[model samples]
Target: MECRFPSVPGAERILSDEALAFVAALHSRFGERRRALLAERDRRQARFDAGERPDFPTDHPGLSDPEWRIASVPDDLKDRRVEITGPAERKMMINAFNSGARVFMADIEDALSPTAENIIRAQINLYDAARRTISYRDPATGKDYALGDKIAVLKVRPRGWHLDEAHLVIDGERVAGAFVDFGLHAFHNAQALIDAGSGPYFYLPKLQHHEEARLWADVFAFTEEWLGLAPGTIKATVLIETLPGAFHAEAILYELRQNIVGLNCGRWDYIFSYIKTHRKDPGAVLPDRAAVTMTVPFMRAYALHVIKVCHRRGAHAIGGMAAQIPVKGDPAANEEAFAKVRADKEREAGDGHDGTWVAHPALVPVAKEVFDRLMPAPNQVDRQREDVVVTQADLLTPCDGPKTMAGVRMNVNVGIGYLAAWLSGRGAVPLHNLMEDAATAEISRTQLWQWRATGTRLDSGETVDAALIDAAFHAEVEALREALGEEAFAVGHYGAAADLMRELVQADELADFLTSVAYERHFAD
Candidate 1:
């Protein structure tokens, strides 16, 4: 096994011959299956676009089986009340581990820009973090950073099935990003993590069907046997982020029963999925992103159903990201943000969620306070949520809020801003006081496409058409340029980002994901 990929800093240390061999083995064994699954997704999506509505199957086999249960939740993963999520960047890696949260989700999927250096270096960070040797020193300030006595339990989130690792090729074919991430981390650190009182864990993303979950289960099984580990040593939490995935939550859990421990209400991606899945439905138009809070009817139904399904199968029901970063100097604004975070977590806790996620460390205490007060036990998996029932109507109900012109401007502004930041190798960006990532970007751009496709009407009595949307896009870009000034805008990939955002929003057809195109053309090495 000779490797031919481009190198990164400390690449040899992370990508040893044995590790590369392990990754290659996984690629060879599962690569074809992954390609088939992705193609299946396109086929299903095409059927959906041609007016086939998605609904729960009436002949859902064995749904009434009362005896099947998922594997037991490991101790380190049992209390995930405050899981802080971010990319596995070096400084962020050290900070997140010591952030005092119960669990830290080192995300390589939506929260990370999949640059070559980023993909390889992230594995190195996780390897070092697992060995308790993670540290970083700011070269400019000479500030030393190291892990603290108190640290969060680490869980890795691999890229979704839709993505591929262009930097890693095995047998003259590019490997799936999920395989590279999972194979490397599991190969290098699974046993060491188990030795240190934890186990290899993952949060699966963007699963559109139970078959995809089944694919992941098989991968876990194969990896464990190949690595000489126990069959169920690896546990996974599936993100019910798509409409089809939400409807098939029970089936998905069943497919991965032996290696499943939890289900997350991946709220942002769910919104994006709603738009993509229902783009052709004239009545499926969503309101402004601001108005589409978790309290909306569709969102509420999805959240409750996920909790119900997870608890029914003896697994944790984790809530989605709060995405609130505390304000520094403004006391009133900070108080309002804290109040919102507290309320969201309280709702999740009261509704039978075992744990929840926060994006920033500052909001950790707020989230922890809510869950701690509500959950005195390790988890609330015992709460079966028998009273909550979600019908297909409930999940598809549109909000009553109006889609306004201001909403159009906001989407273009934030969408372009996030794209610039993403193209510059930053995935998690703070814009207009909100922490945004690929999920938000996905929603921003997809919503624009959806509105245009459906001829959505704004509150100002204007229908969404190409001319109106195009003008909004250009106006927003010029405003952003002025706001960022010549120097700051010129320093990054803002020019390319503006063009890409405009092309995506103004095109006749919607792209599956903006990053899929952006990564291939701009970031992939």
Candidate 2:
């Protein structure tokens, strides 16, 4: 069959004939199943909306096997005490590798704006990094940026299954964004990565079920066979970021056991998913975004459950991101933020998590220091967390925090600010001194949806409804406009962002992903 690989300007370096064919081959093999799985997601959401609550699947055969364990993890992944995550863009890629973390999660999904240029450029960057030939120079300062003498292990995150690469088409169908990212890297750099003392490692994002994991494992098997490499040449870590993914963590690991190495409690996206999965339940309404910290009951249950399940199955349990960037000029604020990061990492390590994530290079040492003290070894998988028991009630336990009008205003500000930055080609944004990603925006918009749906009362003695939210949103916009000035605000796409934010939060139908909707309307060609 003929393959029609769509062309994007400056994509030629990565889109070699063989690479395009590799992607096309994957599409031909698994595209239909990918579509079917997405359809299943819609069906499951429908059922949930119809009052079916998520419980452990009754028919999963692995649940009955008390003695089964995942395969031993590879050496490179064993000591993931501190990992840094960032976009796959060129400069960010160079900076993260030099961040002194044990692993660098090169993200093409949530942390990146999936513009066609960005996607293709990211592939090229990964290829260069794998070849140890990646370097950059500042256009203005002439400062050279390159790999450090000491570098972190590289783990690339492809776009989630829900995203389609509109720039890449074959047989009159757009290619799955996941396949495009995975295929190019696997084709051009998999062996090169192996030669550099690492393999083609990955962090699978937004998996809703074990079947989706099964599809990825199948892709790995096929790619290995097609490339004449040994089976299991790839290792994957599933981000248990969805409510469904959290419920079936063990089954997910089991499905990809031969090639799966770990599971990360992606806290932000999990919160977003929690709100989204139960948007209809008045009982499921969450408190203010800031109030709903990891120490909250439901989040705590999830963290403990993931650690227990991962340790029981002989895989690594990685912790979530501390998204605070250290303050530049304020020493006291930096100290305070560092203290919070230290405390958070200490808790994760104490709970038997093998590693944790940080968003900025500056915070890497803070996270590393905590793990270094608590974990004398590479990991604490032997801890087993046998005493940690989680029930469905625990997972479903509502957060016990007060909702406030201040939190509402903060959400409106951060959501619109992030969307504006995202629409302007920046994905990882800093708003109110916190490093905000798509997950952060998801929480903001989803909270807006839930608060409006449930008419949640805020601490100010006012019930949250459409009018209240709209007023807050407009107020935040005017405030931003005044702060940013006319020229800056106009260039920031604040108006478009405001429209998009309202559409997402106030729409009759909830969107599964803000990026998925925004990408088609604004970013896609």
lDDT of candidates 1 onward, in order: 0.88, 0.90
lDDT (C-alpha) at residue 492 in model 2: 90
Residue 128 CA displacement from its true place in model 1, Å: 0.1
Which window of ten consecutive residues has the lowest lDDT sum in model 2? 1-10
- Residue-level lDDT of model 2, residues 30-69, one tens digit each, is 9999999999999999998888888777778667788888
Q: Model 1: residues >4 Å from true position, as ranges?
A: 1-6, 58-62
Give per-candidate clash totals.
0, 0
Candidate 2: lDDT of 12? 78
Residue-level lDDT tens digits of model 1 in 348-385 = 99999999999888888899999889998988888888
TM-score, per-candidate, Cα-based? 0.98, 0.98
